[model samples]
Target: MSVVRAGGDGRTEADGTGRAGLRTLLRAADGVRIDVAYRPGPGGREGRGGPDVIVVAHGFTGDLDRPHIRRIAAGFARRAAVVTFTFRGHGRSGGRSTVGDREVLDLAAAVAWARSLGHRRVATVGFSMGGSVVLRHAALHGGGDPDTDAGRTARTRTDAVVSVSGPARWFYRGTAPMRRVHWLVTRPAGRVVGRYGLRTRIHDKDWDPVPLSPVQAVPLIAPTPLLIVHGDRDPYFPLDHPRMLATAGAGAADLWLEQGMGHAEHATTDALVARIGEWLEKRG
Candidate 1:
């Protein structure tokens, strides 16, 4: 792993290589850091413009080196600058996971890194928890109502967003199994683990999924296109989540329910690759 000091003086590490001229860059912020593996197009020169830049964010407990992440990044590398990174407290990155709260900052840092590398257009493709991070970042940074607490200055402007098997609600009200899982994992275990200063396990912390819900952030995305992909067989968020997001976003969003697919499993399918490529082609 390669370590470096982020703009905020935090320690961070990188653990992957780029295709062709592309490279991996690491950044740290206030003791929290993230790893961004950037893959430039084959014929593209460093610091030169390319087709588009796509930031691939992994799910909770995931990292830049995950097989699914690498696959998605490889798929996009042919047409755009693809970047995959580890959220804080995961893999070579530092600090604890604040659910999707602080991870937004990490995403912002990744976006800045991509911009610095000469990417003109940017898009964020996230899976599960990572999907929430991208949505929340887009909502906070996108031009929205300035009066709301969720509203903040736009840090990174994205041309589009793609979410795979992401939840629209943190509490999982309608899904009994998911709610049980949340209560079982986050409530007691999260508190216990957090007390020891260890990373927050899946069910340890009381993370308000509402704040990260794309249903709430849809309006904020406004004209920015959104592509919501989920497995019909997903036991986590269920199909209603994406359906609601699509309905809420009106025509600004499109929902793709992969029949027989499960959470994170769709990442490996050719359909996903085609869908993502089509979306980028239309929006890039």
Candidate 2:
């Protein structure tokens, strides 16, 4: 594994134009080589002393350079250091998708790397499968009173988490169309595509979906700020998922239901960016 610097005072001005640099390396625990992108704070007054760090995880079958990933990273880079990465088997990263189980470790490694660069206050923004990994990481690491239902251990703690179009339940509860879609992607045919190192599906009979359930982990993120953003029209993760997450988290979370939005597209909205920026400012 190798680390490459993308932008910094010496590299580029913090004008939101610096591209995310890629770092190719293997995760210590699983030996999966992953591709990471670092978008450093811009130089001069605007780039000086940014927030802790914001680590971004993309949805299933997504890459580090996905348009949504770049958009979100740029949005946060205006205020903080942003790190985006592809999980193993996706994009330029190594290994096949382990669903969301091992990806948590991948995120943990990224967080550790960010902190090593002197970022103390860390936040995670995850979409779809990436969101599930963040929730699981927080549940295991976020220092909360133990909950037996999830059977999780605290792994890493973050100041805030933004989950967009992430489902609380891995298995479909009410969405028939989504269930059919998930099944098609997780089946053997999906695995065949995955063999070619492509992200195929989130569900597979060989893979246990229980570990990817964010609903079970919501309560554990108590006291840590949570932002649950879901599109009212998202077919994959219906509106109910965020509602249930908010209800479970109570005061610990804020829900943003975007009208006529779907899945990751909500991140591209200007209003959403302003809301998130405002939230970060208030928190800071």
Number of the top TM-score candidate: 2
How well does model 2 score by local distance difference test?
0.69
The TM-score values for the models, in the order shown, are 0.78, 0.80
Total colliding residue pairs, candidate 1: 6
TM-score of 1: 0.78
Per-residue CA lDDT of model 2 for 36-108, tens digit only, reads: 7577754543434324578888887788767767777777777777888888667767776776777887887
Which digits, one per residue and each the tens of the lDDT, describe model 1 over residues 1-284?
46665444334444355223334545644546566666665454455432377888888767777777777777777667677788877766777667677788888788767766776678888889888888887887764332333522433556678888888866565777566545545676545554344343333455654455667877788677788888888877878888887888878788888888888634448657656876767764
**Per-model root-mean-square deviation over C-alphas:** 5.7, 5.9
